[model samples]
Target chain A: MGHGGGGALSAELVENVFLPAFGGRTLAALGDSAALSLGGARLAFSTDSFVVRPLFFPGGCIGDLAVNGTVNDLAMSGARAAYLSCAFILEEGVETSVVGRIAGALGDAARAAGVEVVTGDTKVVESGRGDGVYVNTAGIGLIPPGVDIRPQRARPGDVVLLSGEIGLHGVAVMSMRQGLEFGVEIESDCAALGGLVDAMLAVTPDLHVLRDPTRGGLAAALNEIAAAAGAGVVVDERAVPVPPQVASACAVLGLDPMYVANEGKLVAFVPREHADGVLAAMRAHPLGAAAAVIGACVPDHPGMVVARTAFGGTRVVDLPLGEQLPRIC
Target chain B: MGHGGGGALSAELVENVFLPAFGGRTLAALGDSAALSLGGARLAFSTDSFVVRPLFFPGGCIGDLAVNGTVNDLAMSGARAAYLSCAFILEEGVETSVVGRIAGALGDAARAAGVEVVTGDTKVVESGRGDGVYVNTAGIGLIPPGVDIRPQRARPGDVVLLSGEIGLHGVAVMSMRQGLEFGVEIESDCAALGGLVDAMLAVTPDLHVLRDPTRGGLAAALNEIAAAAGAGVVVDERAVPVPPQVASACAVLGLDPMYVANEGKLVAFVPREHADGVLAAMRAHPLGAAAAVIGACVPDHPGMVVARTAFGGTRVVDLPLGEQLPRIC
Candidate 1:
């Protein structure tokens, strides 16, 4: 099964296998993060595992990704990520110095994100049984009052906003693996998005949807939101930002930038009325300095996404079967 | 690296490598579970990953181990586990039927323990990059008011109660590998301990310490508590429960039951005054039906453990340098 692509196959796996066995109202919501009310306090929880190859990428390693990924997942639910549990599966012969460096990166990332690594576990496997390392992080976040953000909240006329340029993370990781330089270096956009989400929520509590363009990139995320909300999205290709270096890298590698992963970028759907305010708020944040509105949801063509090219042609942007770039996160 | 042993090597890795990088006040406690206060609610958080081989053993599989292990960790903190996040790293070539069965077992275990698998993640590694499956479960449990349990709380005169027989889980796993059986079949004692803890907590809220003798069995757990509290432990070898079947299996394999693994047993430290009540409460639960006062905390020989044999002889019970039976959980 092509489960890692975050496409139809992945959705089916969750719906048929996971949900049927672990189904509940909270999990059934299928949001980026699961929201729970515990002892009168609203909380959001999420987990993600990073199996990126070449432990050290251009701008980030598995450590920062493990921290920032879960933080971003919680942030997408309008929650303040507070604490994380990091569990590492290390191969037996990995160097202690390497482990120390990764842990240092993880601590730095957690500190920068304003979250604590309060609990952790470490297990080592036989040398041949595992890669150098695999990190799984589970996070807990506090959801603010009167704020609701979920994919199902998207409606017709909701404006879609992109936080910044895409494809940097995928390109950066791939560049390292291929040992090729495209004249200019492409550093991963790997980062924590909680502060950026906080800025957007400051504009209004009415934001409809928040999603990070991760495993399957913006296309999968948009398609998922559209499918969940029973809405359709129409994006103008020219409005979507892509750095020239990353664009050239993708071109050389025969990859679609639209479907390539991004660690820090997020796509939000805001109600039309508050679109300008939310866009302004997002643009002001350092993480979202290049934020731009690229699309809008429509009632027609429900559960579908289409992008209008600069040449005035429309093409369907469907989810890829499998990850175009495996383990790029 | 001796990471699987949960013994001296594991402790060194944590104290020397992990703690320095990911250190915080809560994490410094080094309890079975880390206690955190969020929104006025005290919660216990912990994580454990299972890489048990064969996927299935006599009485349990990785599924139940993954669920029960994390639940037991939270239970050690005197918390009622509420939710768990399960993450699976599956090898690409593994059969889907195996995955489905594991998920089914996991669901059943969670339901029986009264905990929900609220959020989860699945990532498939290319064939040969992983074993059949490795599961990582992170759990959250809420601690009741008036309950403050930690390893550092053990004190002189605290009675140590062993919940049940030792070494069953380890023998069960090894039995399947060796393809030999004792006169009586041995089954893994893998199970959730939350209910038993709840029952004991009903008797008194000040139970000093709770620990599951899992990887390095009672020796490692007791050594940890002793070292943490700056106290010593003295146990009667005759009083420690060891089922005949497990005892025979350990004898034939040249293993000591005390140093073998147990999944569903716990050792608790209770003030002498409340020892009888806590013992009665533990015996009332099926999981703790064999509960007995096996040891006591003593001021002499601080940070050490000694066992008085039935023949009027005493021997030091030191923590194993590495796991005698690896991946027994």
Candidate 2:
């Protein structure tokens, strides 16, 4: 295991190792979720393991993060999540109260997302062999008819819309982990995006691509889509919204907001004609009130993402070599 | 996390913590797998985490065990596994070659089991926080029409049939971990049982209950079924089949074969009228050549399992308070 950071090392691991070992057409697509068909019904399947440190955070904990992470992945495929399987690995001697709180949080999150935890497993390890608790969730969702969303669908003239502010989750987790007091406390933006996704799908089911920028942040997500579609993404740096506190924290910590994780946000690549309607729908949703048109897919500089700065200078926003914040969820 | 054993503590954790936290009719059943209806298709879903020590065992490695474990869980619900999602938490500094071997074995196992690895994830943790590698697999299978199976379906006069020999899997892993020589090398019975289940299902679709004797072994499985169905299981001690080598090793180690884990074996509760037909079908399958009728459901002493001793005495076989062998898959 080279590095857990969702960066070049992670990409290499998947390309060099996992892809060769687990060969199949769906996995080769490398989307946030895999679209599948079972018994004539279209489905989306995805899995994620949460190892976030400092179990409890300002706005959410690992419990809710575990539930939302996989749910958001399924939503990215334009699927409404229906069922999930949860597995927990706990360390010996860990407080049962801590586990109870986590389980309570998980239950609440599942209820809020309107999905059921249909099956689960629990395992315990010796005290020193594991962190307090690690959770893995795998989910299956129903892909509505006439909807197809994937990274490779990003083509020239597609509008790139971001759901809200960036970098709050990474900044929030890091501040709590290091005991740094930013004048204003920043809470993690961890929430289920299924409702927001459904709202956008109502506007149009012909979305080209939808991605939740979690690990490696917006930069990584755009880079992946660019590479997959063999198209360039040109962004208006000034158009991207960053809250005041998160901006100050990232500046003080020398972390770029572009590469910081956001748990409750999504970036969509939509056809230009439907972009206005989709943006309107997203703005109406509570979760996407601050949605903005941050960029657009371009034909120039294929397989790259370029940002036009306020000073009229252009720079490439590349995928980070490693994560700036590890275990941020 | 009192003990990582699938005994009293595990049961309490599920009953007191998980059950209340994740409440739904499907999960309330507490079956080996959850039977669900999605878009007019009946599906079986299950998940398992493999933390067995000594990644490479006598007969199989953690990779194949991960696939087969979840596959077997789904098969217990009489479903043919179609897809799986694998998530790996790797410890830093683990050799890439070792991961390669594990992934290779996983691919081979999935092919052998006739399931596809559709989606997966990988995360690396700092060394010492995790064992070399831990795998979690969640699978979904299509349940055929007219088949209804669950633990609560057992009733009086139902015959209990075991798929094959017991205790080899736990013994094989233990010998490797502690470097113990039992005179004869015992390989783990770690094969997928989907084909064997299919052969059994060919005879009839009205089987009552099916369980894979894994972590807590035959005793635990029987106790669970008896409790669920509010019936007693009466077993003829002489009729339960244990291999001679396994019996010898268990005797030397002061372990009872009755409480030892078996990976590729299953115990089925069949209506007495159909017992002979099902037994013949099981015996005809390669994985169930040693199938035997070890017990029968009875009305006396409900919610317990009793084994008739060779001396014609009956004794209750209580579930162990903790596991005799920890991390035996």
Candidate 3:
């Protein structure tokens, strides 16, 4: 088989990768479409794909990762996440239990996020044609009244805040893939950012930009924002947080903490005047307990991002020059 | 490289499989997303996948496929087709072109869909751990009150119509995989069904169930409708047209004409009184000149479909016992 099989394989992908990530009451309807009530506002729609390897990793798996990834993307834009559609690709011979666990996790996570997995599809390939399972999730959310946020809105004087530590997700997943287990648990930083987003919105309706560092990590995300907003960004390295385990792993792997992915964290840009209020709201959320003002926009570094080192040295953080942890996300 | 890359292999799959079958504007967009308005609706959607052979096949593919496929999927759903988030699995090696093409295709498809490629991710695989590219698409569609239709609405007195000849799409692509050219050329029926869907909706507000028979052919579609609406469908075999080239190819391959897949074609069920009006409307469209009233819904054999044979013998059509064509879609 190539892909798009409506059988066990397809079932596995959905059960494993998607259902766990996005399963909810609306999703329980199992209808071809998810019926939703937006409470009246334009919908902010988004979709995402997850082709992670080892499909199963420490802390969380692809199922929850996929669900939260899309939900967070929608939330970043200040949208109240709603329904989701999933599609899957399975390499033949993948264990049914693995898929089942993934599905269960995805379902749990989605329910937690209050998002529903409405409709989905699956396809399977012969042993040599595909990976174990690859998932794609498309989500829709309604933007509440007075909440406007986008990368372009990061003004010159806006404050850049980070929700938590970085690289835990990439390192946790990598450790599992490499069969390395730490005596102390180090969970992947996989989590849905919707709650944190909501809290931020509760305090600052005019938040400028919100982004989660995934594939290319914080550096990739911030640089993208810099380019999109046409504004320079400056951060104090001393203020950036990284767990000891994550830092150790990155150092040993010769990887940059800033370039490693983080699933549960978010970086936000808000009016300088509202930064403290927004930080307080973010810190109130468990996912954003480590929230801190990390940087601010500057005119001179348009589309450029620089950081003051822990050694008090300034270094320009250019766009990722090479692939980071290959596909640690 | 995993799927979604837009490199040589991806190109080969497109040229050899998808392009010949689904050539059109949707293909032309080739972006991270497609941009289009649903006229009065404030919604966007599309669907697609990149299940090309040689998984890590040409160019920076797999990753890109995941992006483009989802973007296209949303387009088919008849929405503005806003944003996409991508996931990937990478085999060892699978160079930059692999990543670039996938990234590029995502960029291209998004540009074409008139939507932004907002978020994404990447993952690596152990050698022999995963195949190259296997893309899946999950899209959204905005439904306007006046354009209500679904598979379950086929009334007993309604007529059946097809966007184009059946099986050509499946035949074209299969022909490529088998290396059995039609001499006159048989391309894969890989195409985006958005425009034609739009056209169909424009023609009749009375449109009922609209289905794209990617796998299991037109027969599968009809059977599905029969089951969904709890009605019998009887087709005048003669009226259900097939291209000479397609028929000839099927004959040599020993494949049933009704069991093949179709990428670009759609089967529609409409009220009997409106069948002629809809046929005329479809035939006038470039992609639907072969549109016809192949059958009608009836009260007999509830939940079943019967196709009057060319030899005048009636045959029961069921959802192809298992799957007649695997991965055809």
Candidate 4:
């Protein structure tokens, strides 16, 4: 019933269940956001629900996560997010002040992202029936002319640029859970990436693909794009940025940094000719200051991802059946 | 933290928290759905989340409720809903078959309403962290030209028409929860109202207002419109149709039929001159087969709803603080 680990099961659910049930052309594409033409205007629509436990966490809370997550999904489709609808389900007996604080956070986040919360609904469940509060945000964005981005648009020579370090969000959330710490306080990299994406699009609107490694982390995101584009991808493991603290946390916790989730990061596949310009533009943005060219699309093996280890050996980075950390986002 | 009972508390929360946090032009209108111009196209967007205790009920499940609820909200804006986004938060250890059944119901509901489910998201929570399933659906629709409908459009001379018999949906879920029968087995009136709305719009595009009576009953719906329009409303108590089974069930349960929710019913305020044509069109549709003009907007007692009893006395139909039966929808 619940297999959204961003692995084989998640794909199976979409292929065998959701697609067949919804039965629409755009839905079959399985992009992060659905792009469609309505009344002669191209628009992107997307939705996500935040159920992360302990509503407040290091660096951010579920409120901002809900806003940024959907915003990033819209950005992945090269859309300028304009409006958002926030619906919340709250459990009885929760504090009104808590809700007020979260709403403030959400408002701040939406303003920063340049989107307005235009419509919303609120429902309440009995105490113990829900975990504090869960937020669902659905957004609408306009796709600019001459901008076309999708996973299947990746080509053989496309460069894969990662926005920043991996595993910070997951590690941050885990550190606060059960009173465990890694000697250093790590904060979640949760922020709206629409501005960063707009910067990149300003450089070149013809970027092939863009994705946020959220649920299944960089590994799951890369695998999904490779499978969708029917192309092989190779990443230099050492080039992939993992902050020293995050690396040590993963090492002590027996977790793979590649499969740990990120909230404000994105991986873009740009044409080789425009890669340098795009990389430079990304570096100029605060969110992408650590942006690195971690990998590239290849034609050797289709529908797979391979990582070249520092030990001079290559290994397959398969999508995990389920995420090592659940509800990290 | 939870005050969404469609009553005074709900209104206060909206006034205090939501309006302040998401302050904007359309949101200030407090319509069922927000109408905005996006890329030179007029669009209606609305959202609702289903947190009904039982995932499945008599006539519909949470899936259909999630679909039809948002669809009806868009319909209230005089829009033809085009696309919908479904997001699910499922509890771990739930049965896959249950999710499948609900998805099938949602798909069927969307198809019947002539809308497509274009984008979706799924997230899972650990056991004991969430209810069995909660579904949130947000929809986009196109509003036709010159068809402006809003709650504040109700005038003193407008006629109020109700779609059908009330209190069935609330009773259906209540009966299932308490394992009690109403002797006649009341099924829920859960359904999409887009087609029925289209039928009325076909007669006249300038209908004053349309609102589906969900979460709140006919009384709450009328009170809200009255308060928003700052006009008094008078209802012929004998003319408001309540099925015998529902009346008896409410009697047995010590509930007020007027405050019981109805999912498939709508109350419309139309100009007196066009009331006959709109009523004729509403009756022609199966969903509104029992449509009747039970009330009229009045200039006396502004912002209050008066129910004229059979004996010549009148009673104020004030909004309740919260629903009598929680999670009925």
The deviation in Å at residue A208 for candidate 3 is: 1.8
Q: Rate the local accuracy (lDDT) of all candidates.
A: 0.90, 0.92, 0.65, 0.90
Q: Which 10-residue span in candidate 3 chain A carries the lowest summed lDDT?
A: A1-10
Per-candidate TM-scores read: 0.99, 0.99, 0.79, 0.98
DockQ of each: 0.70, 0.72, 0.11, 0.69
Model 4, position B210, has a per-residue lDDT of: 96
For model 2 chain A, the run of ten residues with the poorest summed lDDT: A1-10
> Model 2 over residues A1-329: C-alpha lDDT tens digits?
33678888889888888889889998899998899899888999999999898899989999999999999999999998899898999988889889889999998999999999999988888877789999999998999999999999999999999999999999999999989898888999999999999999999999999999999999999999999999999999999999999889988889999999999999999999999999999999999999999999999999999999989999999988876887887
What level of docking quality does candidate 4 show? medium
True contacts kept of each: 0.55, 0.65, 0.15, 0.65
Task: Write one digit per residue (lDDT tens) for candidate 4, span A1-329.
Answer: 22866677777777877787879999988899999899888999999999886789999999899999999999999998999999988888878888888888998899999999999988888877788889999999999999989899988999999999999888899877747787878999999999999999999999999999998899999999999999999999999999999998988889899999899999999999999999999999999999999999999799999999989899999988876887776
Query: In CAPRI terms, where does candidate 3 land?
Result: incorrect
lDDT of 1 by residue, A1-329 (tens): 36756767678778888888876778788887889877667889899888898899989999999999999999999999998998888888999899889999999999999999888888888877889899999999899989899999989999999999999999999989999888888899999999999899888988899999998889999998998899999999999998999889988899999988999999999989999999999899999899999999999899999999989999999978776887775
lDDT of 2 by residue, B106-127 (tens): 9899999999998988888878
TM-score of chain B of each: 0.98, 0.98, 0.74, 0.98
Candidate 1 regions exceeding 4 Å error are none
Ranking by DockQ: 2, 1, 4, 3
The C-alpha stretches of model 2 lying farther than 4 A from their native spots are B1-3
Q: Compose the digit string of candidate 3's lDDT tens values, residues A258-329.
A: 878888889999999999999999888898899888889999879999999999899998666545555454
Most DockQ-accurate candidate: 2
